[model samples]
Target: MWSLPASFLLLLLLLLLGQAPPSRPQSLGTMKLRLVGPGSKPEEGRLEVLHQGQWGTVCDDDFALQEATVACRQLGFEAALTWAHSAKYGPGEGPIWLDNVRCAGTESSLDQCGSNGWGVSDCSHSEDVGVVCQPQRQRGYLSERVSNALGPQGRRLEEVRLKPILASAKRRSPVTEGAVEVKYEGHWRQVCDQGWTRNNSRVVCGMLGFPSEAPVDSHYYRKVWNSKMEDPKSRLKSLTKKNSFWIHRVNCLGTEPHMANCQVQVAPAQGKLRPACPGGMHTVVSCVAGPRFRPPKAKPGHKESRAEQEMKVRLRSGAQVGEGRVEVLMNRQWGTVCDHGWNLISASVVCRQLGFGSAREALFGAQLGQALGPIHLSEVRCRGYEQTLSECPSLEGSQNGCQHENDAAVRCNIPNMGFQNQVRLAGGRSPEEGVVEVQVEVNGVQRWGAVCSDHWGLNEAMVACRQLGLGFANHAIKDTWYWQGTPGAGEVVMSGVRCSGTEMALQQCQRHGPVHCSHGTGRFSAGVSCTDSAPDLVMNAQLVQETAYLEDRPLSQLYCAHEENCLSQSADHMNWPYGHRRLLRFSSQIHNLGRADFRPKTGRHSWIWHQCHRPRL
Candidate 1:
């Protein structure tokens, strides 16, 4: 043990004792601030502070951007963009530590701000304050980082695929089952199967887009090749172009995101001898499609015979359309995909499969709720042209050992529909359903507020559904207090809406101009569930072509058609139905090429009647 001088120890004790009690003991020592609560983003949440050795909530009374800036900076963010009250991130428990809080926005910590002292508040849990900080500047959310090789001897694996050389293999869905071929340097080359194992096949299957790998009959392949070698016109010509084997003796652990992550060799253990494959032929692999790819009762072939492709893929736990946690169906059960090889191209495939355009963003780390059910797919590889997600390649989710935390999600490119212009839905498991919110002006301030439920019915919901392009109204709900999504959406804005059932949108219907509600203080917003198996309206072009004719009809005889705005502008300017106008006439057949029958939004009696009449004097 080392000895310290008695004079040095006395001086240190005297210096500490001479220092007066620190002005902000909590800020210098014990006080710690954090964002907590559920259904919130990482950069935004309910504010909680550590005081007296336990976590406590902050009251919203007078809490503004200045206070939020201090809280956010204390929590390691750049600063606060905005602040929320009314438990926007959800309520918090424990003591309400501070009330009537005030900050100059330059405080280094929340404890430095003025308050009614710690653990003293008149606010309830519902009044917990929250803050939204600026999002992180950069993050790799889709594909995870991977090295080209396990060691310095190799580089990152970028591309690989399957080449179907067999006559039958060429007929499948881009050949779900085929020989494994990898891209190296600049050419597509074969992988020698001399010591190829299932682990190697697993990696290959993942690269292609299948969920799992199956066994291939090597004897059958060899038997067919021996008999077909004499035919120059056979599919074997595809193989003759590539005489070189680029890879040999691959050893994969089956969990690598790409084949390049596994061990590889330029030559075999036996040495680089002629007839590279030797006793073994080129590597062959068979892929098993996930349930998501295998649409129910789908006709097998490369050509699609139906009017529309069935969708087995869906989004969940998203507040709006085109963005959500990705879920695919298998055996009538829904599951999530792991973000192993997830990227924008792969996400775009899933998006287009669901009738959207492309993926605007590929999300990772389960930004939606922690997924439920099995992880179905992983290591998905998409070429961006496939009509359905199943047409791409992927690996089984279980093979990658992924958890709910790695569940992949996507934000798709949706049609330019104006549904969100005046209305929106929130707080639902999926964007297809939620509590309805309407944009309204309150005291000259325009904001989103809840719609009153009086006279709300399917007639109104039908317009809402059509406006969203989500098909038809399955349910129109009142008293929607359970789906509490947006915090400020609880403010009741307008009431007494009555749709005529034929309106194209909810706003076109009649409603009270003044703000009114039976439950102004409650979260009783109108809600809806939309499920549209819309009847396909297809014009019979063949019929129209055969029966088409051009005629010069007298404008006076076309009064009804002209009044209905069916005539061109030339007719609108013509001498009062006295001149002749050339018109194209055709007899056409219209077909309902969909699962549901076409039904009018309103009864025939409610339809408007238009008739030709003499011009008013």
Candidate 2:
């Protein structure tokens, strides 16, 4: 206690020793510059920094902007930044390589940084160019060092997240079956037999809300029937032929068949054919012939079964109870009618459209739940006479209330009409109106035959054209030529083809041709005459006129098949055609020459006419 001053001095010395030495302010140096190339070896090219006196490559795994910012700060720069590359920075020639350097934002230096080992590349080296501690200066500082680091050569910092890459890699896996469950409302449920069909595995998968091709394991269940099932062969022959007579199979667990286990309904009349059996089993047996089939006799003293008698009467009268008609309430509105005054005749029409048996009875006043719209018609009469419901005039303008509370309803009993059959057309029948030509094939040789003019009426021609799939429309009359006698000996006598003020001769008409046709007028005259040998003479005349016109022009270019053939008798006869005739002739000669020298066999020639010209002869 007497040495208090000495004790205080000793404590101060101890405290001084415990405290750390002052760091030299890190020398306050500017950040270094580095460039990373794709080919640079991670362990070699990496720059070594005096961070805690230990060297390590920056890990390139999961590098981010925040990490880069911290790195730039540690480098003595205003903002810590990073650059990533996949290619060598100017082809880093030396052995120094830092392939993948992942760094946390707090890394003190490029060398002393935590990473996913050395060579793991979070970013490609080709894109990397880095700057270390960069010197900071006020506006007046003029240091060459700062100038050198401020341009394009400076490192660029990029921010990127690596979690997305990891997530993408995790998503590549094969799909499996049955492990997934479907949720309905609040509960998840497994697929049971309720809605499954054996014919299609897809149906089961779809009902369970899974992919149609989902894998399934084998499953089986027992079938049961509980009704008085009649054996197929034991039923009446007539009844067995009917589709309604067949019994359907069912599945069950108990020895006795239950109604729920049965897949189809069983008929009562056929019940007497066999006894009720457990499991709903059926056996095949020959049907026994009996008296002409009749309904089973009712026991005596039963309320004189008015139902059966009423059914018979309805059947006899052919009245339908459920049949109805639809009418257009207005322009586009449609509504149904009630069978208030419906009878057998009207019932027949409705039943026919509905594809049912003849009318049994017509019901009135909302039998079908509700009326769709306004009642378009009222007093209805059907004698089974009209082709369509719209043809029934008696129902036209019948007053019916539009109160929207009641519907006009009718019922008609109808016999079931099966599917319609195909329509057949008679041979050689045209589906349109035109001339009827019949061909008779004898020994497989086609012979020119007589045209059956008698069947050439419009209706007959239409039928014929329809048969051959051709369109029929009226063609203009041009010319008329009559031939007397047979083909080889026939003599043409052109006569009796008339032309009205607006009508043109068939031979001269642009719409048709130079063939035989009758005009609108009563008088007939032939526009032109020619033998069969000169059938196209009219067209030839037009071609000749074009050629003659070319020859008569001056300053014309002429083309010929050959140089020697250029001066044809026809061309030599032309008057005053010149200026480029030789050139044209040479071209024509070359073109007409054999395929040897000229690539194409044709050429064009322009002609200017100096003299007025008339139509060529």
RMSD of each: 23.0, 37.4
Q: What is the lDDT, from 0 to 100, of the residue 221 in candidate 1?
A: 77
TM-score for each prediction? Answer: 0.31, 0.16
lDDT string for model 1 (234-331, tens) is: 65544534456667878987655456667876543234346555566678888765432443354221232121235678776553445677888787
Question: Which whole-number lDDT from 0 to 100 does residue 65 have in model 1?
Answer: 92
Strongest candidate by TM-score: 1
- Residue 89's C-alpha lDDT in candidate 1? 83
Per-residue CA lDDT of candidate 2, range 1-617, in tens? 46568878877887888742222213313434332322211111223232333332343334455555555554334553344423223323322223334455565544444433323334433333333222232221111222322211232111101111123323422111221122222332222222223322321121121111223332211121111133444432222333232223323221111112113223224446442232222221111111111112532111222322222111110011222323333445455554445444554454333323233334333322333334565566664544345555544333644332234333332111110111111211232222222233335753322222211233332222222323221221122223222332111122222222111111111222222333331122111111101000113333444445323324344333223443434655545544334221111111111111222223434333222222234
